[model samples]
Target: MHHRRPKNLRKPLLGGGAFLLLAALNAPAAVSFAEQRYHAYKISRPAYQRQYGSWARVEVPAEYRVNAIHAALLHTGKVLLIAGSGNSQKNFDAGTFDTVLWDPVANTFKKVPTPEDFFCSGHSQLPDGRLLVAGGTARYEILDGEVRKAGGGMRVKNESPDKAVTLKKGTVFRSPSGIEYVSKTDVTVPKATREFEVSYFGNGAMKPWKTKVTAAEARVFVEAVEEGPQALTTQAAQYEVVGLHGEDADNVYGLAQKLTTEKQDFQGIRSAYEFDPKAEKYVPVDPMRDARWYPTLVTLQDGRVLAVSGLNDVGDVVPGDNEIYDPKTRKWTKGPTRYFPTYPALFLTRGGKLLYTGSNAGYGPADKGREPGLWDLEKNTFTGLGGLTDPDQLETSASLILPPAQDQKVMVLGGGGVGESEKSTARTSVVDLSKDSPVFTDGPDLPQGTRYLSSVLMPDDTVFTSGGSGDYRGRGGSDVLKAQFYDPGTNAFTEAAEPTVGRNYHSEALLLPDGRVATFGSDPLYGDRDNTKLGTFERRVEVFTPPALHRGGANRPVLGNGPAEPGADGRATFATEDAGRIAAARLMRPGAVTHTTDVEQRSVALELTRGRDGRSVTVDVPDDRTLVPPGWYMLFVTDGDGVPSVARWIRVK
Candidate 1:
């Protein structure tokens, strides 16, 4: 019934009706917003947090924030975050390297003086609690189209047996065809190797020995002094030394093949250093024999470190050459030659052999060195194990030594196809390395195909796995926000509190002394869903408090005074108020992690004995150095409710 009384009344009535209609139309959005707010409130409540756990982003000051390519839990209860040029071309060009020391307990950050680009380097905790970091990027990659000058590896040979010839940077070498190339760095070509050959006579009498001098060679990166195709060398040719005169010029020469404007891969450096946790400084060490990028450093049973697999100084695989570092001598010696892809998942077994989980990060041929096996360093042999599912999709996978080092079970989590491929896998496999055959068996699958998943071993014996991308470098907005806890006892995964940040390539997660997990780094190729925007490196740090930590208030057992340094196979007493409630104790090796590979993390169960006075607990440390590597560990005791106490730092000697 339309009744228009007056002009003003008609306008007022229409406005009121229109307002009512608009309110009705916006009801769904209002309800959705209200529901979202309620959900947020509910999750923030104590009960919800206690059940599903919680995440808190650390407020890192802008200047202190860095691209954390590698992270290590130092013995000082601080974390060493290394960026080292931070994957930025500008930083590399300006020689601006970065490192930061973060004290999680104190919530403080300090900028460290970095000496070199430690990006993509490998690290492991030394027996004395020092972190041994080896290898780094020497030169950034230059794509095909963007390259202006032709460059490649050059072999400088020394024919004289006198002494090594040192060629400084900018030393020029001229091709026979009249093109000039310059050395990018200083190169030392060793003197020729002298050998003696003795020829025996018919009566077994030795004849005069003849000496033979083999040419000594050193490889260095060289580039054309001028840009374009004119400087390209299509065939192998001997190059004359530009400055050397007479015999020196004739004895020392350069040789190279195929210098062109094609793509140039990332070159590596021979620099190495050890981070002293107490001093909070990186002490320079003897450089590695081979320049390496993306290498893997595994601590041997004797506290020596084995370095393997990386892009060399010339941007090629390191071949089968590996080396070992001895802390006693502060020197590196030649190691067994067995090639594996960069950042291969290698676990040291109690039997003194390394188990390769067939899991690796980037850079290798798909067909070679991809088999899961036991590497006998003594014999220099690798015995291949079978039954790994989705073998092709093993790059960027995460592997862990299942809790209780006595069990000797290793698991490989989700992975992706070789080098930027879209293929990924949800498959997980576990192998009982203690078994005679030790073949991988299918474990529970992930919810979806994932890569770069970070798995941390909890003191309570659960593996906290979180954050990965389904696509390469989280392309197409594929960063998975889910987290889960894999219970080795149950051989299944339980959903965990979802993480707000996305972690992908170059990211790492490690367990903190406070029973929480800290995650850092993610370099995505694209930032948006449409894949048009360039991605930014994630510098925000996130900490995840496991559900066990939130259980039944903060009444968890507390770790008091304990042995600062305990010998293996010895009994150590610790003061704890809740000793009577403590059910188990574990020595968890502090993690030195990078690129989703953390061979250092292992949980070794200790024999626990409660003191009669109810104020102390004694734990028997395992004598097996392989099981419990001599280093700093977080000694944690768990109560009957699976709640862990704050960790006590103990160095196992």
Candidate 2:
């Protein structure tokens, strides 16, 4: 029966890999998709809204509330956090900064020099050990490597705030770095307000903590624009910081998103600049693709560059279209698929599925940002497909989860509906892929509903959820130090023995490749305050290791109730498995099958009877008009227990 099979049909896939895959494609034939590349699934309910906070994994500090998150991976398997907030009320909208590192190796945390904490930029690791950062505030935060012009040098403000002025004159020299910037103003006003705002730009030197001053403070390149309608304005221009290479702070450059006047035409600002490690200056190179704002920059396995999404606006209330940027071609192309309007949440699953979860379209109750979605890159434009047991609502929640293994189950930690809630919920849901429903089990619920809670999955298949408050929208909130963990077997959650730091919006929990989990940030929604800061954003990193598992449960193999196989006790071996989850077995007994467990192995026993005329009685289970596969069998019956008393072994060919 082993003849040449059609290319479309490859059968008899046996093993764990096949078992897992079969579950995913259980209904492959029933789905008709427009793009063979991507298949779409439907949902009965519509998706819902936006959640605001500098709530994520950040370790930066400021004198104000934090509101943004930046993630990076170090060679040591440690996760670095650059948390910032642009809504600091200290001196108007001046933001704060902090740096946090979660070391997986040592299972702890450490603090590095603060990176440029601009708003809305992605971080990438370079071939060397340095980081390549791009985008954020329109004005830049330059740090490492920059080459001065052949006979030139660049000078930023270092003295009086009166040296800089804008046209309309509402406010001027309010540096994007959130520090004091001087303007070549009437040069008369003396008290322009001096706050502890720090800007890591100019000179490229590691100034341990120098206060920023205007150019007149023993510097050069002062300006006085007596031009056009924007006349007599001496505004200093700024650029975004890409890196901070202290020792060899040379050949550095800033990248910017292409500016658009009307939001349509993409005037491709394909510029690449070189930074002189010596002079600390910027030199522009030929452009590369169109400029993108807040796009994700990832290094492919093959050393290629890809820029995805952020093709819309920085201030956009919703996520936008997808696009691809190639480094070699220096070109931009639209991505084959559109992304779910998800925010503060995107993951590349262990199964190679791209997940975009929890986002609002506009502003409404229906738009409370409760939609979780997935996309298949193997095929293009394939998403809007998800089948939760409820199949109706999608709530926004965050957590850490270990991937599934033959002996391990994935656990989801603390997640609840976002935006405007009464109390914080500490519910933990666990998914045992080894089962059919991939159903969710309940874990401990927190005292209140943690709106923007954070989690990090540890190595031992256990999940850890840290600090999240019982407050909503920054109103009447209190600290939730009690942490929780999930156990799948019993489908429950319990409080961990330890307590975590109090946290609010824009905090992060990182699991280092080594073994530690770093927790930091609380950029509170109120004005910048210490208790609100958590100091988790500081250098101190906490390490945690959940207890190890002790074997106890019996066998739990994935099988079906298809038919009874001929065994000493009627049970067929799942040895001849396939990519399809549909399994079949035949019984040697003539009676119906019954479930009985022996040493954890399920089997059936049959009893046969003789008819009055001394002949055997038979019962038929029809395969009426179809040819079944070689392994998928039917249970033959003759009188009792669906087993055949005579001619028990029949090979149907």
lDDT of 2 by residue, 1-653 (tens): 78887755555434556977876786565353433323111111111001100111333333322332555444333455544333232312343444445444344554443333333443333222234444333222221232111111122222234433112211122224432222221111222234455455587654355454433211111111221222222344442222324421121211122212122211111233322212222233333333333444433322223344432222232233444434345344555444332232333333444444332211124443244444565575434433333212223355322322233233333344434444345554444444444445555555556555555443333345656655543344454655665443444555553433455554555543323345544544443333363223222334443332111112111222222323433323322122122122222111000000000000111232223443322223222111111111223222111111112222112
The CA lDDT at 170 in model 1 is 94
Return the TM-score for each candidate structure: 0.96, 0.43
Which candidate achieves the best TM-score against the true structure?
A: 1
- Model 1 agreement with the true structure over 375-491: per-residue lDDT tens digits: 999999899989999989899999999998899999999999999999989999999987877789999999999999999999989999999999999999999999999999999
Which one wins on lDDT? 1
Q: In model 1, what are the clashing residue pairs, if there are any?
A: none
Q: What's every prediction's RMSD, in angstroms? A: 2.2, 28.4
Clashes of 2: 90
Q: Tell me how far the alpha carbon of residue 43 in candidate 2 is from the true structure, in angstroms, after superposition.
A: 48
Q: Report every candidate's CA lDDT.
A: 0.92, 0.34
